[model samples]
Target: MYKHLLVAVDGSHTSENALDHAIGLAQGENAELTLVNVANPTEYMALAPEFLQHESYEAAALSEGNSVLDEAMKKALASLPAEKVHRHLLVANKGVKEMAQLLVDYADEQKTDIIILGTHGRSGLMHLLMGSFAETVMRETNLPLLIIRSDGEA
Candidate 1:
């Protein structure tokens, strides 16, 4: 009987799978879904990018990030009514605390009842190598979280 669901998405295949699952669940459970995309924080990109100084890649990358969030919103909203879905693109160019806290803050402001995330599914040798955003998210908050594995597995 959840009314509000906050979903963290990145526009990756894993995020797409999670979006489909979130939408389906929202449809079945009659809940509202919020699609969230976090921009590659400026911190991740050098302010004066070496590439920008030396090449054209920096501008291209910025353009790509701008398009990505909008594209994610379009794809996520395609599944539901405008009234039942909310889209957010946040830029936290710093620590995981900022990222996690911003989502948590948004959820609190929206009165969210749950959080849905698509796990990228880096496991075994790869899992240990890469860690997981979901794992970090899971550790940081008490919000109800639904972690969906990316497609292709059982």
Candidate 2:
């Protein structure tokens, strides 16, 4: 029933699984597929203080985001036609919004019927500290979500 589907890819194996699922769903419904990646320069800078150079960090983040989107587009192309699949790379605004919010907002902006994402499956203290992007997206959006866990749990 979905006419358009949005899948978030972070170049992880879990996201690969989610992309596979999205491809199947898109094929079954004859829907358009949009693959999105959000790059946060602040994150890379914070994690690697030695980088120190703002330009390098921003370049790295954007490069990584494009790489992720390109890889996902290649994979999706193998299953879906080039015309049916699209890609978007978003740069996160530091301190302005969380990644989950960015994903949700993008999905809405694209008018996607459903959102598909993979969960890292962190739990307990780790879950509390890292938080769950899938959970946050679900809470932030009113659209339908298909969350695939790292261990094949849905």
Candidate 3:
């Protein structure tokens, strides 16, 4: 019985599945849905200075983030009315862990009843290297979380 649901999307297939699930839950419960996309500042900061300047990198990241949010909004609107869906783009200047915290903080600000997100399901070396925002969020937040694996593994 969620009143406000927050779904994090990154234009990936996994996130798309999560969005679909969130939409279904929202429709069934007559709840409001919010779609969030986080832009990691570390990505831009990692780029070589000669290859790309910081200002340009930030601009590109923001643009891509907006595009992801727009695409997610279109898919969400197919299942729910525009009035029932909200969109948010968060800039995570610190890092992945901070990104997870930002999501939690945003959920608090929005008074979201539940958070829905998809896991890429990376394991072993890849998992170790890439880390997981979903895992971090789960560990840090007290709010209810629904995690959907990309390949239906969970």
Candidate 4:
């Protein structure tokens, strides 16, 4: 049984599905839920022009991350008490570490019993080009992972 569950959300449909699944699992086990949204400033900086300031890009990323966490928290509050749910907004440097690594590190820090995430199920060229965060997390972390595929089901 999972005592502490961590669900990562990015405001995508797949992530919503994953949150639903996490909610069900947490409710069944009476587990504490932590909703995590990670903002990588380097991602925006990579696409930014030379004149763009790093601080401005990081601020925008942080704002977006907070919005994503707020939306996810609303859904969580519907099923769990506000006190039972915790929210974290993480800012990671993409140049130093990937999102999967950051998620894993946070899970370790929180002592999470399980990790839940959604996968878009991209394969072939698309998979290669975009990379799979879920796959990377599963490979890197030793904890149990429940991955919900994007198939219009929760």
Q: Rate the local accuracy (lDDT) of all candidates.
A: 0.73, 0.88, 0.89, 0.88
Candidate 2 local lDDT, 1-154, one digit each (tens): 9999999999988898999999999999999999999888876766656655446777888888998998999889998988999999888856324888998999999999999999888889998886787888888999999998897453
Models 1 onward score TM values of 0.76, 0.90, 0.90, 0.89
lDDT of 1 by residue, 1-154 (tens): 8898888877678777877788888888888888776654444355556545424443444455556657766765777777887777666665555777777778778889888888867789876775677887787778888999877752
Model 2 regions lying over 4 Å from their true place:
47-54, 95-97, 152-154
lDDT of 4 by residue, 31-126 (tens): 999999888777676664765644588887788899999999988999998888999988887632378898999999999999999889989999
Any runs in candidate 1 off by more than 4 Å, and if so which?
A: 42-66, 124-129, 152-154
Candidate that would win on lDDT? 3
How much is the lDDT of residue 88 in candidate 3? 94
lDDT of 1 at 59: 45
CA displacement after TM-score superposition, residue 142 of candidate 2 (Å): 0.3
Candidate whose TM-score is highest: 3
Candidate 3 — number of clashing residue pairs? 0
Q: Which is superior by TM-score, 1 or 4?
A: 4
> Which prediction has more favorable lDDT, 3 or 4?
3
> Lowest summed lDDT over 10 consecutive residues: which window, candidate 3?
51-60
**Residue-level error in angstroms, candidate 1, position 63:** 5.3
lDDT per residue as tens, model 3, 21-92 = 999999999899999999875687677778774367667678778999999888889989889999999988
Error of 2 at 153 (Å): 12
Off by over 4 Å in 3: 45-55, 152-154
